[model samples]
Target: MSWPHVIPYANPIYFLWLAVALLPMIFMLLIKGKRWGWYQSLITLIFLYISFGGKYWQQGLALIGYVIFQTLLVWCYHHYRQQKNASGIFYLAVALAILPLTLVKVIPFVDGGAAAIFGFLGISYLTFKSVQMIMEMRDGTIKEYHPLRYIQFLLFFPTISSGPIDRYRRFEKDLLEPPTREVYAGLLNRGIWSIFLGFFYKFILGYYFGQVWLPLLNKSLMHQGFFSWSLILYMYCYSMYLFFDFAGYSLFAVGVSNLMGYDTPKNFNKPFISDNIKEFWNRWHMTLSFWFRDFIYMRLMFTLIKKKVFKSRIVASNVGYFALFMIMGVWHGLTWYYLLYGFYHASLICLTDAWLRFKKKHKKQLPSNKFTKALAIFLTFQAVCFSFLIFSGVLDQLFFHH
Candidate 1:
């Protein structure tokens, strides 16, 4: 079968097709206060085919295998948890859920920098969802599993490629309960506005910053030394480009979900305005940060505390931060810069935590007015941008590769 393949929301043209495809569902939700499941499924398949079809068919096959693997894993775990729960089994289930993604991440490092056969875009996000399900199942929070609904949640095309990473329970709730007409109207309005904002961010600003000026800055920096003005400019420019590109994509995902009457979580919230590293993480990539906090950091802290591994809560928390960021860095890739990027953030967060504790102890003596807040924000922004410079892998290209 002949078909046009496009990455989700990669360009303006895709949005046109998206709008056309969504109109019928939009009407149905508005008029009936319910979704036409079969129709939604058909459109989802079409879009998935468009994204994973054509030259990307290998990734398509990989995705199918991944979905089946996760589905079966979760199913088995759910049944087992229902009968009886064991710590060993829960840990095994979580590990098995993450195994494919781990292989996909590790293979490139050992295989002469070749991509894994099983790797596909958004593998990390899907694995997160799968692992979350298994964990919740262990906790007895998720009592039942509907195979079809679970599949639909995984294949939800709007946020499939990259995500705001909707929670299973939240997504299931939306799936089961369509919004009322008044609420749907507000959602539609917000969705349209978000789409327009996404266009401005991704197409207009992102194109200028990333496609146009970034290369120019890089070319200039290449001829000059490391500490040149062009490099500094490139840092800020690249940071802006990264924010707009990722945030724009997130807005599109969220906007599309809203249009369909599902309230997926928001990803960004004035991240640049944050006064500290902790606040920045809270604002930027909100879903991912919260996921790491809930699934990794909190769990690790609990284990350490429960086992009496550390006497001090502060020390335990700091260790947890390091472990969490290191895993996150490795998740990004098994690369030097990515690893450094994770460590960099971990260090910043630890220092910020220390400062906050000190401030709390001496609240009366320490300044807490507008000037201090502005300075904190400025410092935090610069530190974050510097970390992004590392995350960009430009330093690796400049120093190591060259």
Candidate 2:
């Protein structure tokens, strides 16, 4: 069979190759307390080729162009920031950074549902990093931009395709400061365990849910109708599949990053057990949500508050949630389901905030107990599952197509 290496961490063979290539690097970290940069660079190129080479050569070219474009954009923005941090210039730089991603996201709808030529697998994540650097540069958090280190941070292969999306400052710190052997030993242990756990989650559990159960439930929905028991079953099953598949992938990404001496932030954190929608955001796809929080929601709220756009802070906060989720939804895709998914989550969070405020005002009147907490978890779980169903896009297919 041909190599199923087009996708990262999805195929067993890809991990096999990765493990072999990482052997020397792992040993070096364990023994010498330093990474061989040349060797690291070599493996990165090889893996990037494996992911973007041959049948995907167009993607490879696109990635190279994209990287160069972002590197230059960042460099220019850095230089501009040094001279003067014009809000207008900062906004323009941010816009330019995300322009490629915007085209990639919007092209399908505009171009008879065709993928953009410049779109690569990890384009969104890369754009996030680029925009982050620009933002930080505006804030003077990241004062300097070294093109090579920027490229290394942007293209770090382990978390490349789908990320735990490392921050440039955090990544650069690890790159500049190699871990001690003792520290690396712990990281190595965690890394290996995470990989094996990922295998179980993705190959076994994710396979069963996504490959077997999801397909069967989907077929059942087609025959049994949208309001049937099957749909309910499908919702929960699809949620499980999504969690295992994505969380498993995140585990693998984080695991591999640990091996390479970077403390990549985790994407998932027992999200299923979150007590409320706000708590869920904290626990789920954490990197992405946190990125949105820091870069999008926080910034927008700051702007609104600073400008006194809304009469009340509560009103401003609610408006911020809607804008944040709508933007996030649009980022996900131009589809109705994706938009609804974002809207639904934003609504949930806002309502949760209202409840929290009311509960706080009531103080001793509203009971705080195990039963209340469990009930909240249960209700929040159902709300989140429904949101995931919207995200699954099966409703659009089931209702619109059939």
Candidate 3:
């Protein structure tokens, strides 16, 4: 397990080794109609070491500690949940689950901009898995807890660094029931296709946009004033780069999962063609948005409605949207741009909701046709790109820090 430090899915060498190592498991699944759980676990450790070893040994250690903390926390919560479902206990468990990630997000701001000692890559995503488990346990969605399965779910190597964020039950089913040979044939084909597509997206197009054009744009914009047309170009360029880079990583994760016989979810779905802000979320980063929608927005709305917090469901839902996105923004970081990015999206969603209601009320008055749909898409694209610009933090560099 001695190779130069490798980021997961970042280089061809990593994937080459991954494919070779996974050969045994793949063979067992395809030829013998069996899953070699022991072999799979061995390779999981090997890949984790390569990704977290060498210069990143500190992060490796941090990841180990984080996993242990989460495993124990979830186990204890599950134990208590069997006897009683207390709101205070559940809230405390959820908070504890997210505490490490919270420190990771907040510490840098207050600690002379130093990264938290306990911080590791994918802490936020791991925390999401942990907290979701606790919530579901409280709701009795998960009747029993299995520690090994939970750890495997959290540390599924393909998605360890970033995620399509598989749910416990969804993932557990794939583990409990190995895909039939016929079903696995489809998975294998799709898996290979996804990996090749990911290469095109991440290595080629992502490189051109993020590594090539973005720097060139920045250099040109530095010469021009902040309000120049080049800034708009930068916005669109950054947006494209962000999409390709992330979507490409996601494809690789899903592809690898499929190869291993797990039906990992897809993250992106041609997001730029969305009809509105809400639809954009449905397409883009589908897992994270869907996770937040299910675990945060829906829960908040339910709580509000249950307690009669607002007279109108619309107002309550709108408020829940703000809470959800604001939490999401903070999870990204405490920077002004990140905060504003969250606020901006929340505002757009609320406005979009209002317009939708208006459109429904005046269905005959408003035209619905291909031309109108195209117009909606075009406008939505511009708005989304602008939000990405804020997300890019160039404005903060140009205006505030300059």
Clashing pairs in 3: none
Error of 2 at 99 (Å): 0.5
My TM-score estimates for the predictions, one after another, are 0.98, 0.98, 0.98
Model 1 worst lDDT window (10 residues): 108-117
* lDDT value, residue 70 of candidate 2: 94
* Cα-based lDDT for every prediction: 0.91, 0.91, 0.91
Model 2 TM-score on a 0 to 1 scale: 0.98
Cα-based RMSD of candidate 1: 1.2
Q: What is the lDDT of residue 223 in candidate 2?
A: 94
138-243 per-residue lDDT for model 1 (tens digits): 8778889988889998999999999989899999999989898888999999998888898888888999999999999988988885878988999999999999
The sequence of per-residue lDDT tens digits that candidate 2 reaches over residues 1-402 is 554446898677898898899999998998898999999999999999999988888889899999999999998988878888789999999999999998898787778435547798999999999999999998889988899999999999988888887889999999889899999999988888888888888889999999999999999899988879999999999999999999899999999988988788888889878889999999999999999999999999999999999989999999999999999999989899989999999999899999999989998998999999899899989999999999999999888997
What range of 10 consecutive residues in model 3 has the weakest lDDT sum? 108-117
Q: Which ten contiguous residues of candidate 2 have the minimum total lDDT?
A: 108-117
Off by over 4 Å in 2: 1-5, 112-116
Candidate 1 ranges with C-alpha deviation above 4 Å: 112-116
